[model samples]
Target: MTSEKRESALGALQSNLKKGHVYRREDLLISSNAVDRHLKQLLKSGVLEKLSQGLYYAPKTSIFGRLPPKEDDLVRAFLKDEEFLILSPNTYNSLGLGTTQLHNKTSVYNHKRHGVFKMGNRSFEFRIKPRFPKKLDKEFLLVDLLNNLNSLPENKDVILANIKKMLTNFDLIKLEKYVLLYGVVRTKKTVLSLLHDLR
Candidate 1:
């Protein structure tokens, strides 16, 4: 009788969740008594993939087999909120500032959860910041690059020189605004000195 109920509950759950969509354990609306058993059954059957504790997703299979869940989906489920920004030091490589080293970690800027979080076999360094841009932009990236300069494994003076040269091509007004809004004390000071040189 309990097995029958679990089977019925699993069927209802499978029908409700669309493929490739991540669902938190709390997202289930069924009675809580057998929810754990139902999830275990589903996992054993390969109908769902357990991403982490309390997080599951209906597998999206392809010719290559099952695909991993999207990073945004994992983050949304983990944070239980959509307000966050994802970035990586690798972004700095595109700026042509001579930063050739590759980094494995990603940074998640948000108001909540300040610590490292593991998502789908990847590490995300969550930083609690007072302010962050809704979307990444070149000017903002420049400011962030300087903000994390000391952390990067690179020659700082060379990178700073390259950035100083590049700033002349950027919109001074917008760059200044980004500096004020998101730049750390060290970053702001450096940008201000560069802007003064530009004048």
Candidate 2:
């Protein structure tokens, strides 16, 4: 490609990279040669930040420093789809339960990509669950918290008891529905037992 064509392609590509948005090479739909040249130029000029292979983002700058794109945006670029949920065990701590331990890993419940993946400066634990919430909800979080209880480094009985107490404060109907639909068999059993105790 001529210098004019390369510059034109780069301009077009840059036009599409909205700030705080993550992108993939294929999303540009430009010829491979031109796309690569343009991307290299953009990267060299600090206009675009490459997160990984074929994935890039237009950083959001702040007074502190350059802010990375949202986790969901990065995951979308990694998975190439919006059908995934990113969560962390630390979310469980927000329930006011007695558990106070901090967790460093973030979990990605996605259909594709099963295993841990290092994206940028963070690590994501990808799990392929048959069913996962399209969006995060308290009810779903309660259910998921129960579902992964066994894997947590805490006292199971104590957590269950705490969850039992916590259940009384949530919407019973929604919690029940989430347990039956999104929760595993063990979680269902625990939730059912807790509900039965309330009745």
Candidate 3:
């Protein structure tokens, strides 16, 4: 690959960036045939490391040798679909959820079902759930926030504070709507109980 082509590819990669470690060929360019060939050459030269077929990451050299590619590189490559959002293991762990319990390699909850794809060595999983009404953003946010808070480190005070913050910022009507939508009566009671305790 010529320096100019290589530079252009790198520039593209740096721009249009997303969270996590992986990227897709389509993401790199509108047309990736030439870009893929050049990227492969870069891989052969040790300029980059191929995580899996069609997935690559810039490798960092250590005094001992080359370090392994970051896990996010593989994740970014696997999670190319715009419809599904990728959640890191930390995020999952924070949510107090376990990958083993999920029984899928790559699991994401969405409103619509989609087929899985393999990128590099990892497998991606998608989950389709019922969709909510358009006016329930606050409610959905609170539900999501509660779910994630459960996964966070155990700190009662912190959790209470966050819940209060969420309640303060959220619309009460939306909260009621979300409670009805998710059937989270116990969660609503818990929030109310916590607020009472705070008082």
Candidate 4:
């Protein structure tokens, strides 16, 4: 492709791209004179941001500066699947379970990928689990807190005691359901033990 044709192709490709929308390499092929060349130039010129192996994003900018891609969008593109759930440790603080430590990382539970991945400035800790809720609820949160208690920075013994007291605040059926469904063996024992103590 000649330089003029390349520029025209690039411009055409650019026109089709919407800021903050992500694209895959194959998705851009039909619109490019030379896909690789166009991608290289676009990256060099800061027009496109590489997300993962084949993912590229047209970033959105604001007065503060360039904006990071939305978490759901980033994870969806990275996993190439929409079946995923994002949970932040910061959210657990709302449970009033004495989980006050701040956490910067977000956990992604999905069937496709397992391990940490960095996209732009954020790091996602991907965990492969057989089951996860489509949306978060307090019942699920409490169960999850027990499931991951060992990894948390707070005092586990006190947190477990706190969890025991907060049981009445949640739906028992749902809470027990999540514990049976999502809890590890240790978590199951802990929750069961707590319930036994209550009785």
Estimate TM-scores for all models. 0.92, 0.90, 0.39, 0.91
Stretches of candidate 4 above 4 Å error? 193-199
**Candidate 3 lDDT:** 0.53
lDDT of each residue in 83-104, candidate 4, tens digit only: 9999988888999989999999
Relative to the true structure, candidate 1 has a C-alpha RMSD (angstroms) of 1.8
**Candidate with more favorable, higher lDDT: 1 or 3:** 1
RMSD in order of candidates: 1.8, 1.9, 8.8, 1.8
User: Model 4, residue 123: displacement in angstroms?
Assistant: 1.3
Q: How many angstroms is residue 108 displaced in model 4 relative to the true structure, after the best TM-score fit?
A: 1.0
Ranking by lDDT: 4, 1, 2, 3
Q: Which candidate leads the pack in TM-score?
A: 1
Kindly give the stretch of ten consecutive residues in candidate 2 with the minimal lDDT sum.
28-37
User: 154, model 2: CA deviation in Å?
Assistant: 2.1
Q: Give the alpha carbon lDDT tens digit for every residue of 1-199 in model 3.
A: 7788766875565444433335555556663436666566656765655555667666556788756555444543455433444443333333332222332354455555566755445556655545444332445645654544554455645655656665555566666656556534567676556445645
Candidate 1 per-residue C-alpha lDDT over 1-199 given as tens digits, one digit per residue, 9 for 90 to 100: 6778767777887778778888888886553446787788888988878877888888898999888888788888888988888899998888788788899989999888998876567788999888898888788888999998999899999998898778787788999999999998999999999999988
Q: Which stretches of candidate 3 lie over 4 Å from their true place?
A: 1-21, 29-33, 51-53, 60-106, 111-116, 130-176, 179-199
